[model samples]
Target: MSKATFAGGCFWCIEAAFSSLEGVNQAISGYCGGETDTPSYDAVCSGKTGHAEVVQIDFDDAIISYQDLLTIFFTLHDATQLNRQGNDIGTQYRSAIFYHDTEQQQQAQGYIDALTQDAVFDAPIVTQVTPIDTFHSAEDYHQGYYQQNPSQGYCSMVISPKFNKFKAKFGHKMKP
Candidate 1:
């Protein structure tokens, strides 16, 4: 199994996006790209930890390729929007890829470069390709939040719709 880490918007939303995929083994909601070793949700939200809300996913490479994951990552969030995704405005909501190795970094940059050349969006893609630093696991309640609290306000109102659309577009890539 290989791992991929990403921060597109809220960890909740991004986790939901990749957790149920065909190759995914574990989906962890955490904090990365930060100054501190461990940061709380409130601390990160305060915009002082310099962390983006990220999800670390473990997947089988034989079942799904990293390039394919990169494609889904770009599709899930408006990478053109800097330090924010929709109404979740903050550095913690920025688009980023916490690459585990040089290969991952190269692939991410290559993907972004291709998107730019293709003019995938009117604005430039701002997703940062950073090395995986210390990833502090978010509070227990945060892990699998959407799955556990499907009826919660944010899950029901925001994540559900986004996840449904993602499922529609990537259904062929997901598990049964």
Candidate 2:
């Protein structure tokens, strides 16, 4: 199994998207890329903790390659949008890939380069590709939030669109 950590706006949407995939063993919604010892959702949301809402995904490489995961990551959200996704606007919502190793970093940079060359977006991709730091698990209520609160205002308004897009594009790759 291999792991990839990413911050693409709300962790709930990213967690739900990757968790639904076939080879993904787990998709943990948490906080990372910050200086705090243990950051809370409220603290991160305030943009004072310097944390980004991230999801740590564990998956089988034999079933899904890192490149494939990176591709899906790029497509699921607006990478060109800096520090925000939809109605949620804050540093916690920044697009980032917290790479575990040099290989992951290279692949992430390569994909960003390819996307830029292909003009994937009208604006430049602002997604940060950085090394992994201490990942502080969020409060229990934050984990599996979308699954538990499917009809909640934020999930319905902000997360569902990305979920729908992933389902439309990668549904066949998901677990049966």
Give lDDT tens digits, candidate 2, residues 22-126. Answer: 899988989999889979888899999999999999999999989989988988778978899877788899999999999999999999999999997999999
- Compared with the true structure, model 2 gives a TM-score of 0.96
Write the residue-wise lDDT of candidate 1 on 1-176 in tens digits: 99999999999998988998999998899999899877999999999999999999999999998999999999888999999999999999999999999999999999999999999899988989989999888999999999999999989999999999999999999889
- The best candidate by lDDT is 1
lDDT for 12 in candidate 1 is: 94
Off by over 4 Å in 2: none
Residue 94, model 1, lDDT: 96
* Top TM-score prediction, candidate number: 1
Per-model TM values vs. the true structure: 0.97, 0.96
Candidate 1's displacement at residue 128, Å, is: 0.7
Clash number for each model: 0, 0
Pairs with backbone N, CA or C atoms under 3 Å apart (clashes), candidate 2: none
